[model samples]
Each structure stands twice: as C-alpha cells, then as structure tokens.
Target: MSVATAHVDIVAPAVPGAAPGTVVGAAEVLDRSNRRLGRVPLRAEISTPVEIPHEEQCLVHGWSPYLSVQPIVVTGGRTQQALLSARPANGKGSGGEESRRAANGWIRLWGREPDGQWTVRDPSDMATGGATAVSTPMGSPAILQIGGGRRRPVCTLVPEGSLFTLQPTEHRPQGPVEVRPVADSGFTLLESLRLGEWGWATVVERVWWDEPGVRGTPLFDLAVAYLACRRGNLERAGQWRQVAGNRHEDGPAWIDVLAVDAWLARRRGEWRDLASALARLADAGGTPLVAEGLDLLTAELARPPLEPRAPHPGEALRSVLTPYLRASLPSSLTSFTAAHPGVPQPRPPKRARPSESLPFRVERDTSATRIQWRVLSGPPVDSGAYAPVADRTLLPREPGLIISELGELSEWLIVEDEDPMVLWRLSRTLLDEGVATGVSIVPGRNAVAVALPGLQVRPAAALLADLLGQGRVRRLGLSVGGLRQELSVPDAAEAERILAVLLREGHRSSP
Candidate 1:
C-alpha cells in the first residue's frame, strides 16, 4: 500500500536570543530492510509568551535544519500557537512548486518506547477538525487522537547526537518515568558505600565519643580508634582502643593496637617493651604493619653525647681575672695608690732586715700630741730618712689643714675653733707611713708628689693625692698627662696597709 502524506507543525517554546520561527530537529529512522524511511520536517516557529498579554514571538535564526513541536490543550484560554515557516538549503523556499524537499517523506510524531525506540503517529489526528477526539487513526499515513478528555501519552522527538527531548500537553496526567544514559551500577554502589562508611567513622569519632548513651558502643569506638591510628594520632588512638576493649570482644584488631603501643613505648624510651611488641607483631604476620616502629628502634641504637656543666661563681671570677692580673700587676700599682690614698702601705708584716726595702714606715710626730704617722713611697725604703716626712702641721686652733708631699699646705684659719687637731693628727699619720699601692709620684710644674709603691711615676704626688681624695680614679686617669697605675700584693698585710695609707693620706691632703 502506498503511504499518504500530510504537513504537521512541531512547536516548541522559544529560547533566549533565538530568532523567530525556530524548530527542534528530529531523528532520522530506517526500516528493517535497511531502506531509507520517511523524514519528519520541522514546520513551525516555536515561541514562549512574553510578559505582555496576547503577543507571541520566537527566535528563528540558524534553525532551518531542526524540527520543533508544542503540545496543546483544547480547553485552555487560547491554545498555544506556533507559526510555520521553512528555509531550504541555499536560501530556497520550503513550500512552493520550485521548493527543494526531502525525498518522498511523510511526517510522524512519536511517543518514546521503553526500548529506546519510537512509535509513529500523525499530528492531524491529534487535532480534530472541530472537537478534540481520542483514539482516532486516519488512514495509512494518519494522525492518531490519543487524548482530549483521556490522558495523552507524552511524545518526544530527538535528533542524531542529541538527547531525546519531550514536551507534555497541560491536560495529560503524570505517568511512568525513566532516566536516560544509565550509569554503571557497580561503580555507583561502591562510591555510595565508601562515602557512607567514612561518614559513620567521623560521627563515631567526633560525636559518639561524647554522647551519653552512644559512648558505650564498642564497635563505634573501635572504628574511631582505627581511623585515629590511620591519621597518626597514636595517643588518642590508644586511649580510644583501651576504652573500646572493655565493651567489645575485639578492640581495634590486635596488630593495629600493638603497633600504636609500640610507637608510644619507643617515644618514652622503653626500648625493651617496644622490641617485645614489635616481635609479637612480626610473629602475628604484621611485620609490614609495624614498619614505623622498626625504624624508630633503629634510630635509638646510637646514644647522644653529654654537655659540660657551667663554672661556679668563684671559678668564673678567677677565670676572668687571671689574664688581667698577669698583664697588669706591679705597673698597675702606681696608678692604684695614687687613686686611693686612704689605702695602707703594701707591706710584709714581719720586721724588715737592714738590706730589705721597707714597704712602709712609722714615725712619731713631736709637734702634735699622740700623733703617729704612716708613710708610703714609690720605691721601698731601707733607711727611715727616705720615708715620707710630715712636713706641715696644723694645731686645733687652726680651722683645718692640708699637707702636700712637696711642702704645699692649706689652712682654713678662718674656722680656728673647729677641731683642727683631728685634721693635724690625720695628716701627720698619712705623710709618715702611707705607701702608694696603685699610682706613681712624678716631678712636674704645679704637680704635688703622691706615694705609689708599685707603678711607674707619671704625675707628681700632690696631684695624684688630690685625684685620690676626690675619688676620680679610673675614669679620670685615662688622659696622657695623667698618672695611670694598678695595684697587686703577694700577701694580705700589704693589701691592708695599702688600704690604710689611702684612707689616712686622703683625709690629710683634703682641701
């Protein structure tokens, strides 16, 4: 039988930026004999309604190769309308005698089959001449009316290399649904199970551990501990496993728990326990599992070296002074005695032999009552004549007196009622016996002599004595013309005399 042909409009809603009169394309189908079947041309311009009432428009630019359709309900306020237009290849018309067309084809719309095939039908039968009808098939190339009052079957048209697309009439009821492009069932199931397992592990670790009723669940605790071990939190993992042991038949599997225990023991330096646990794991077929423990064990085989203790306070001081004393000594004594006149002579306490140099001398002062003086000098003296003499004196009637080594003296005669006797006694004592232990006496213009037992003479004794009395020693003595000296003693008596001479002579020479 020869098939009859009729033109049908396939309408669809307009997409944004599409030109007017655009259509969706359809798939090309072949018969069982491998012969070319009919081509269903897209005939209508599909459009969506604009916000303004009653105006319909579509996008149709570059849509010539595709077919589009829209299903309609007869009872709606206005049936959704589609305008038909076609542009053939090379800008030819699709509708007149001179129009180029597909070979001897009839139009068919189909409801999608369960086996991914199509069941063809006609559009004319779907729209009756007057009233909408159901199940009316018109001739060999016919339109089947499936719904008006009855539910309509959804029909979809798809083009090659695209997904099948469907549009439903408003009057049609919901039916059986299926998803296309089915995914691999095994892969999907595995991924879902893995995600669920990790979620459960997280809940047990973070939430269940603190929950009142859930805290006693051993399986949950074990799972959490296992995850903790995997994450390298040995301390927390061990605690969780220990708690789980009380509630579960098996706690975190023996091998994993033992490995964590071994790691902890290794950190605490319990090498014996670590070795025992590692051996046990190896015997139980867990040698590879305890690899980290074995590595830690190997590292512990070499012991670290010890550090020396810090020096004591006395030791530290001696250490610091040793080099300083060796470099300084006798030369420094000249500056030292000049700086501190109150210091006593640097003397050996035993009586000196006639050939020996006297460190200091004691001389009686006849001019003053009960006044005995000590004197210091730059070089030790064997004869009493070389000792410093009390050249100047002041009586109680005098206000105060200053005796310089070079015979320069000052008296505060304006204050005579003051106890000048004390001043006189002090001056005589220092001049007779005081010995220079730190500084030297040198001759100079405007320079007074000062006694320095151990150092070279750099300044006159008078200026050195003034500097000593003023206590401007170390800092003031650095200048080139200044007599710089340091002091040292082989014994304590010499040191004591040096101190005494400094105090006595300092008071004697005070202005």
Candidate 2:
C-alpha cells in the first residue's frame, strides 16, 4: 500500500530581492501515489499551521527556515512513500543584485527509521518540480521535509504571541481546544518548535490542554523548562518546574522527569545522578524524545575526553545533542553563555587552591540587577596544560543571589552602571585608592568591568567625603552570596553631585 502524504506549502516573503508577492517559496507535499493531503504555510508573521496529515502523523519544523522530519501517519497496517517538491519564488519580481543574493535559497532532504537511522541527501537545486522523496514504512520513525538555505538557520514559521484555533475533531466533539502556540513573548517560534521537536511526547500532551492565554500547564511548563535547560539557565528551569509543580495530572512519566532532573544534576557536576537518570530512562518505555536526549547525552559521557579548547561543559553537551534534534541548539548554547551579552556564565567550580587567575567572572540574574559568580578556574596545572578545571564540588552557589568573591586577593571591584556620574564616581573611587589598574565601561552591558591589579586594599570611607557628605559611612556589605560588594549612595545632596557630574564627565571616561 502507498503511504499517505500531505501538501504543506512553506512560504516566505521576498526578504531582499525575491518576488514582490504575498509568498516566496513553498514545499508541496505528496503521498507515494502523488496524492495531496494538506499543506503547512510558512511566513515571517504567521505560524505553520498544526495540521496532522494523518492520525499519529505530525508535520513539524524547528524555529527556523528549515523544516524537520514529518512524522508519517500510518493506519490499517500499511506503508508507503512521501515526497516533497520544492518551489522557489519565481522571477526577479522586483529587486536588485544585492537583494537577489539576500533572497537566494537552497533545499535538502533527510529520512529516519523507527530504529533511529537517518539518511540525508543534498538536492542539486530547488526549482519547480525538483522533488526530494523518501520511503516511509507504516512504523518508520520519521521522514523529514526541509526547505532553507545552506548558510541560513533561523526562519520564522510563527511570530511570538500569535493566536491559533483547534476547531473540532471527529473523535472528541468537546475538544480541549482554544487559541494556541500560547503567547510566549519571552521565547521565539524556533525556540518553541525546538521544544516540540526535542520533547515530542511532551509536546503531544501539551496540545491536549493548551488554550489561548493559558499559562504554566505541566506539559507546557516542562517544555519551557527544557528550553531553559538547553540555554544553560538551570536556575530558571528549576523555577519553571516549581511553577508547573514537580508533578502534574497528565505530565510526563517519572522516568522522563528523571531524565530532565538528571541532566540538570550533570550540569552541576553530579555524575552519579546522571548515570542513574539514564539508567531509569533506558528501562522506561514510550518517551522517544527523552530517550533520544538520553542516548545523545550517554554517548557524550562515554566518549573519551577531547583536547582542551576552553569549551564549557554546556557547549560540549550542545554539540553532542544538536545532530539528533532540530531546534537551534548551537544558538541557544551561544546565547546562554558569556559569548552573548546577558547570558549568565555558569558558576565556576569550587577551588581547593588559590590561583592568580581573575578573581571573579560575572553574570546577571533574571532581573539583570545583581551580579553572580562561580569560583574562577584554579591555577594552571602547567603552561602547556589543558583548560583549568575547578575542584568538582557537590555544592554550588545559588545563582539568584548577589554572591561576592571577597578575600585577601580581592584587588578588583567590577561596577556595572549606566549613569555617567556613577561611572565617574566609581573611577575616582578605584583610582584615588590606587587599587585598580584599568577601568573599562562595557558598552553593550552599560556596566563597568573593572580590573583591580593591586594587592589587597579597600578604599577608605573618608576618601568619599565629597560623595558621601555628612551621611557618615554605613556598614560595607557583600551580597549575592558574596559575589558583589555593595556601596550605597546615602545623602540626596551627594547623589545629586554625582548626577550633576554626568553631563560633563560622562564621555570623558573610557566607554
């Protein structure tokens, strides 16, 4: 029997120099007999509709220009082939050379079996009638349908906050239907789609009760937490789990939940928990995506250590996990690390011996007000040694607090502030004390990343008479679990003087 297929038109706008029409290019889906089923339209502002070509079959794409494997819907014990025909937007409707180059695109195809084998083929080009076909048996794992450029990864299938309606299905007339994809302004469509692709079983359950304007269902919460975990926001992920309650009525099974919890434990350097989690997931049945994640993680754990390249553990995990799943794991890893502004650096491993390396590395909390730190890497084992590995401790600092790294070698004090007066006051504070060697104002973060190169020295309170006035010195305090030292500006008059200095000295300071 021929496999059933659906027509999904993945359309995009003429980004720069393509046709000047409502749609750009599209993917026309067909069954083994070349019969049409249905189509999923793509665009910048709208969503690729959640159209199940057949029961148990789903058409999914990452939060990107590239569509992922289309889970073939099989019934009545039959297997067949599915075909994807790429149709690029025709003619230079109205654009220039630069515009045309901006609009140029390419396409590719991939196939997956129930046993988890995937095969990929690079089509020569994407022209009308240039179709990429795959054989899908009734029980095959997946058949991918993708469309995008070789270089481009991000493509908008749905804008954040868009609305969706489930309508009615034959089996359940009183379906738990409502407007969908949910208004998650905090995350992008690719992000959510990645969650869908990676959390397949979880996503299936999510649609069961997902409705417009609804928030924090167990399934949806787990997906969001998984996204946060992928982004290295372990603390945030934990909080989301709390919001959704650790357990829910129809949430993931205990084993699947253990999979996520164990992954978090691994990030915190808990190897035993990771092994235990993987063991449980292996014994459990029915959660393929979680199993896939576990398999990817297990391989990485078992593989021999590579040469030191200063790659974070998170980065290593991302590299291992991205091939099997379709969401933008690379970008999430990038955005979750210090490579991207505001991405919190994981707390440094605890140190057994003091080193001359930087005393602290800083990252922001969810509110973006306070700074957080883990211990900086321990002293180098040798000049030619691999990356510094901090002491693997069982306990880690809570990332939400204002942790401070004060000690005898606390020569540097980093002050991140936007006010020019604050910067000027801070520079004077560091310079007059002769404690800091350099003061740099980070442009993007609008905060100062100070370098205190001198020996242990604390600025005297009297030095700030001009700024502190008669308010007298309050007790100096360290917060964020001692990651930051707080200096309060007490008097209104003193605060005014600092604010007044901003217009004149703001640009004078290095920014």
Candidate 3:
C-alpha cells in the first residue's frame, strides 16, 4: 500500500475549523489501506503560522503539510510570507476579531533585493490599486507585463495561484524570441486553459507585446504605472508614466492615464510631480463625465481631513479619487473626434475582411470519457451525422455570457488572427462578459487562443463562424480531449497552393 501527504498550494486550508492566527497542530493518520482515517493533533512547538512551508502532516510522518511530503528542506531563496490561512465556509474563522481582521488569501511577496518595504494592492481602492484594484509587483511571474516592452529593472514575485510560470524551458523561434523567465529576463507563456481572463491577458500580453523593441500600448503603460506606484516603486512608476505620456498627446483615454499618474503622485506625496501630471492631464480632451470626476477629486483635495475621529480617515479621500482614477474613454481618441465640427468627419477606420471559415470536427468517446476537437482543412463533414453530448440549451446564448458545466478543467475557444488589436478587442469583449477563461494573444501576429468551458462544440463552432466570420476571426480552433492542429501559415496564395498540394496528396491538413 502507498501513502502520500495531503498537499495544497499556498491557499489551501489546514485544519477544517481552526481559527485564523490561532496556533493549531494537525497531522493526518492513515490505516494499512491508506483510507478512512482522520487527523491526529501534534505538539505545537513550531510557532509559525499555519501557512505553506510551516504546517505539518503525518501521512507518512516527518513531513510539513506546507511543503507537501518533500524530504529535502530548501531554504535561502527569496522567501515571501503571505497570509493564506483557511477561512470557514461561512467566511468566519477562529480568533474572533483577529481572524476577521486578518488578511486572508493575501500574499506578501519578497524579492532578492531584500528591501524592508511592503506594498499593498487592495481591490477596494482604485486610486492605489490601479485598474484591477490589486497590487502586483513590477516583475516576476513574468507573464503579467506582456508585450516585449522594456523590462522592469527590479525584483518582483509571482502570485501563488497564478497559472503562468517563469521557469525556463525549450525555446521557440518566432517574431521575438522567448526570453528566460528569470527575475532579470522577461516572462513567457505556457499553454494554459485554467487561468481566468486576467491570467490570459497577462500571458498573452507578455508573449505578444513585451518584446525588446515593441513599445507597449498607452493603456498598458498606464496600468504598469499604477501597479508600480502602488508597490512604492515611484521610480518605476514614473518611468512607465513617461512612456505613456510620450505615446500620447491628447485624448480622453490619455487624460485618464495622466489622471492616474497624478493620483499616484498625490498618493506618494510628490506635490510638484502631481501638479505637473495634472497640467498634462488638463490639456488632454475631457468629456462631461471626465470633468465631473476631476471635480470630485479637486473637491476632496480641498476638504480638510477628519480629526482622527473617523474609523478610516483615508476612506474619504479614497472615495473621491477612486472614480477619477477609474474613469476612461469608451473608445480611443480618434481622427473623427479630433476633426473640426464644420468639416466632414473622416471615414471610419477599416476592419479586417472576413476569410474562409476554418473547417472543424468534434467527436466524443463516452466509454473513454474523452472528447476531441479537430480543425480540418479538408472537406466538411455533413452536420446531420453529428450530435452534441451536452444540451445546447444549457449553454449561454447572450453575446457576452459564458457557459460552463463541465468540471474545473477548462475547455478552449481558439481564434486565429494576425492582428493583436483584433485579438485584444475580442478578448476584452469576452472577458468583460465573463466568457473568456484563458487567452493567448501573440504580439505582431494575428493569432489568439482562449479557454471557455461549457460550450457545446457544434453550436460553438457555428456561433464563432457567424460572429467572428464577419472580418473578426480568420481561423478558429477549439480543443477537446487534448487534440489540436497547428497551421503552417504563409502568404494567402502560397498557403492555398500548399493546401491544394496537400489535399491532392491526401494529407489531413491542420487549420
């Protein structure tokens, strides 16, 4: 019989009902068959919090629950101590007020530089937390800052549950070579369908945008600045803000970017810098909503602070700044918007032209409990022969809604485009609607990969062919049972020539 320690990542619960910050010794005991036994209490000699690397288990004995059952003790690497104690299913835990006040699932990352500073990224405060209201380090877990922009010249840490990793692997030859996932080098994308939309964005951007020569989009820089400032890295934040300012002169989105920079400066108490950023921001175009948001910030800035009577004095200032920092233009400042009112508005920008719908097939082996999706470049199969295993009605029909009934393993919704902007738009649309689970947008290439579970294959392929076929999606690939096909892309005519030859030779080509 074999026994193994019950393991968990940084966020797993230790004691089923143990209170947060309350010290408890726990060890799992097993019988000869290695089943049907409960935990046995141990001596509370080690006082470390019940977190990763400290907690203990007794599945085989002499193993820390935090470190799984690994025998070797690894130390002296950059150690980050995060508070990941388990909260009760009802959101309550031990230590009463202490447990309630303790930051659960929040991680404190440490870099090799060994600074004593701790930066916080709280979601409730937009002014400090940036767009996502969560603080992320300037580097590490290298996937966050995608698009081959300039590397952040500082150490950073990846989140515990992050789907992407910086660990190095075999390289690929492409537009921009994949960099090592070192603290100094940038991050690369590993194929993942499990990460949420945010994870996809980070990985896609890293692979597509964070290139050595590629300058990031203005919005991307603004986001970086927000994260940098929140982590008390004013130098890094200022650098990113400068990059953004250099990329834009005037526009509503630009105004919001400048406003965020000004807000960060204000938070850092750099009054002179704040004034300069606001001056630049005021020069940018503003709508009625923008004016109102700015007015709120100015009003709050002019108001006096509560005389320590308020439970949280910072809350008042945060309330005003949050809206201003979050405000952004719906669309980018365009030539049409900048054109004179008397003059005719310039023609709308052209979009991608629709291409041939990539042919695909879906098959399921119920006995094996597996499914397969194949993108075909051959003759199309008759629809009458195919039937969906899952009911189509169970899936969401709304433009932005996602359908997921299958378990946690993510299903994919793959798109092939040569334009990053198109991929970004589609990704943002799906993400905003909570449909996109994972995304892979390679920069300088017109290809995208995303994961969305709960979609029936037949309808999903049809739906994509309809919506994306209208000049949005060029090719599509949806995977099931780990089956996938790769396209050897060339010029259109060249690709057709190759395809014709392959078809003549009886090759089952990929999309």
The candidate scoring highest on lDDT is 2
Candidates in order, TM-scores: namely 0.18, 0.24, 0.23
TM-score order of candidates, top first: 2, 3, 1
lDDT scores of the candidates, listed in order: 0.27, 0.32, 0.30
- In candidate 1, position 468 carries an lDDT of 38
Q: Quote the RMSD, in angstroms, for model 1.
A: 56.4
Query: Cα lDDT for residue 351, model 3?
Result: 22
Can you write out model 1's per-residue Cα lDDT over 360-474, one digit (the tens) per residue?
A: 1222222221111122435434333232222222211101112222232221111011122222222233343443232111111111223333422222234334433544332
Better of 1 and 2 by lDDT: 2
Question: Mind giving the per-residue lDDT tens digits that candidate 2 earns over 1-511?
Answer: 7544343333332122111221211323333233444443333333343322443322212122222211222221122322221212222224222222211111122333234344442322111110111112222222112212222221111111122111111122221111112122222222444445443322322332243334443324444555566666778756655655355323332333665666676666665565565555444322222222344355445543233453333344444334333322232111111111111223212222222111222221122111112223553223221122121111121121112322221333344332333444454456556645654432223244444445123232333333345443342221121244344665444433433343234334422
Alpha carbon lDDT of residue 100, candidate 3? 23
TM-score of 2: 0.24
Each model's Cα RMSD: 56.4, 27.2, 25.3
Number of backbone clashes in candidate 2: 25
Off by over 4 Å in 1: 1-204, 212-219, 230-235, 246-252, 286-511
